[model samples]
Target: MKFLIIRFSSIGDIVLTTPVIRCLKEQVKDATVHFLTKKNYCGLVENNPHVDKVIVLNESWELMIHLLQNEDYDYIIDLHHNLRTWKVKRALHGVKSFSFNKLNIQKWLLTALKMNRLPDVHIVDRYLETIKSFGVVNDGKVLDYFIPQKDLITKDDIPLSHSFGYVGIVIGAALNTKKLPVHKLKELCDKINFPIILLGGKEDKIVGDEIAAVNEIKIYNSCGKFNLNESADLVRNANLIITHDTGLMHIAAAFKKKIISVWGNTVPEFGMSEYFGKDQVSSFKFQVSGLRCRPCSKIGYKQCPKKHFKCMELQNVEMMAVKTIELIK
Candidate 1:
């Protein structure tokens, strides 16, 4: 069987689809898996053993469609059920395609009306539902993130202070609404007794610097210093991870790292929390409950929809630091 699994952008969502790829390849007879994703995310699956071919979505839509038509895949599993994915399905009209349920309505109820109508299942389980027809069952494994040998960080790459072991603090999220304020981050850093390494993309360097300034010797700002896979390497080597609701949190789950994920405008009840499959790694969620405007948005915004920003502002950073200390021991 020839399968084309499509999950186009973003780090965490793409990482969540790994089990589907693995199950299809392992359980099915003569299965060949081809993954389709945006060019920026091709690296995430390029090293995946289960993926036979990785098709990149670039600027040329016609060319991308032409390439897909030629592959003649027997099945199309659409994990990202968006308009673009719908167009891809339309382009390959004759092929049998199954889409993952996005549950947008359920999410709207939770975020807008504060109703608990969403299912109790995790997003990974829902992604697996799309491949049920093929009898592909999840193999009870954690998410996969394969770092290329060239992108691997050496001991010399990180500070000597962190060589022994350090707590990785992911100081950035996709939006400001999903992250702690710069002052709050600094306060948390000041309280952590253990050595800390702040992780994020280049966009987060300035804020990471502000947080690390709390104690330059104890906190190493690694935000702008590394690429995605290199950052994953840092997460892999960490003693524990303290993160916002972002991609690196999911990557830490892939590495089975002990995680304390801090939530802001978004809540873990959205079902995108750190997953361990069946692993016994410790996981913690820190979110302010009882606020009607807690989960203000399903995704997030540049700034708080409400000017107060209590979802993050009300968080007890001191308590979180205490938890971090206990977990490290």
Candidate 2:
């Protein structure tokens, strides 16, 4: 069977589709798995052994559609559930297509009214539900992220004394509302007794540097300095991970590293929390309860709706500090 799986963009969302790729390749008879994602995210699944081909939609879905039209795939697993994938299914006439249910209305209800009537399923599990007809099971596995051998960060990369131990902190997210404030990050770092390493893309470097500058403890600002896989290697080696709801947080879940996931505008109830991991001990949610303005957007916003930003502003930084220390110990 030749299967084409589709998930368009974003780091964490793309990473979350790994289990579907794995189960399809392993469970289906003579399965050849292909994946379609945005060009920027090609590296996320390029090295994945379960996937036979990684096709990138480089800003032009028409070009991708033109190429996919000729492949004559046996199955089209639409994990993205967007207009583009809908078009792809139409073009690939007669091919067995299974699209994941997005549950947008349920999400809208929760975001609009704070009503919690949504199903108790995680998004990853729902992704797996699409292929149930193929007799494929989830195998109880979490997401998979395969870093290229060259990207692995070795102990020698750090100081000889602290190389064996360090806390990996992911302080960046696509939305500003999801990120922990710089002051709160500094407080968390100060409370952490172990050596620290901050991780994020280039955009986070300034914030990371500012946080590093104020804290007395040793903190390595690796943001913008390393590529995605190299950063994954750092997360792989760390004793524990403290992250916001970002791509690296999902990657840490892939690595099964203990995570202290900090939440802001978004809640774990959205079902995008860290999946499969051993000793995945704790998460810190800093949202102010009973704030009518909370969850103004299903994803997040540039700033709080009320402008007070109490959801994140009112978080207990001292409690986070205590949790960080406990995880390290």
Candidate 3:
């Protein structure tokens, strides 16, 4: 069976859909799994062994549609049930497709009125639901992130301070409100006694440099220095990871690294947590509870919708660092 699984963009969301891809391929006989994603995120799924082919959606939608039309897939699993995915499903008319419920209304109600009507399920489980009719079930496996041999960073590539083990601190998120303040991160770093590697994209390099300058010997700034796979390689090698609600957090979960994920505008109830199959308890989440304005956005904002920003502001850096130590111990 030739299957076309569509999840357009973004790192974490795409990573969350891996279980569905793996199960559908391994369980269903002769299932040739093809994935559709944005051109930029090609790295995330390109190396996934379960996927037979990765169909990229570049600038030319017409080209993508034309390419997908030739596949003659047996089923279409629409994990990213957005407008573009709807268009893809429409373009491939007559092809049977199953889409996961996005639960937009529940998310909206949570963010709008601070209500808690959302299902108590992880996004990974919800993603798995898309392929339920195929008789594919969760195989008690966690998320998968494969790193190429060429992209692997060895001990020589890292500072001698981190030769034994290091804590990877993912210091950036898609939105500013989803990230911790520079000073707050520095405070957290200051409290952590072990060697720290600040992880992030090129945009976060300046802040990484600023933080690394505090204690150059103990902290190394790898932000902007490595590509996506290389960064994942670092996460794969880390003893633990301290991150915001970002892509690397999901990647760390893939590696089953002890993670202390900080929350800002978004809450973990939206079910995008660090899932390592059933009863995945090693990971911890830190969010300021009892704020009426918590989860102000389903995603996040450039700045807090309400300038108070107490959600992230109130998190105890000391407590999080202490927890990191306990987990690593």
The Cα local distance difference test for each model comes to: 0.92, 0.84, 0.91
| Candidate maximizing lDDT | 1
Lowest lDDT sum, 10 consecutive residues, model 1, at: 131-140
Per-model C-alpha RMSD: 0.8, 1.8, 1.0
Q: For residues 164-230, what per-residue lDDT tens digits would candidate 3 score against the true structure?
A: 9999999999998999999899999999999999999999999999999889999999999999999
Model 2 spans > 4 angstroms off: 59-62, 277-287
- Clashing residue pairs in candidate 2 are none
Pitting candidate 1 against candidate 2, the one with the higher TM-score is: 1
Query: How well is each residue in 122-155 modelled by candidate 1, as lDDT tens digits?
Result: 9999999889898878778999999999999999
TM-score of predicted structure 1: 0.98
Better of 2 and 3 by TM-score: 3
Model 1 RMSD, rounded to 1 decimal: 0.8
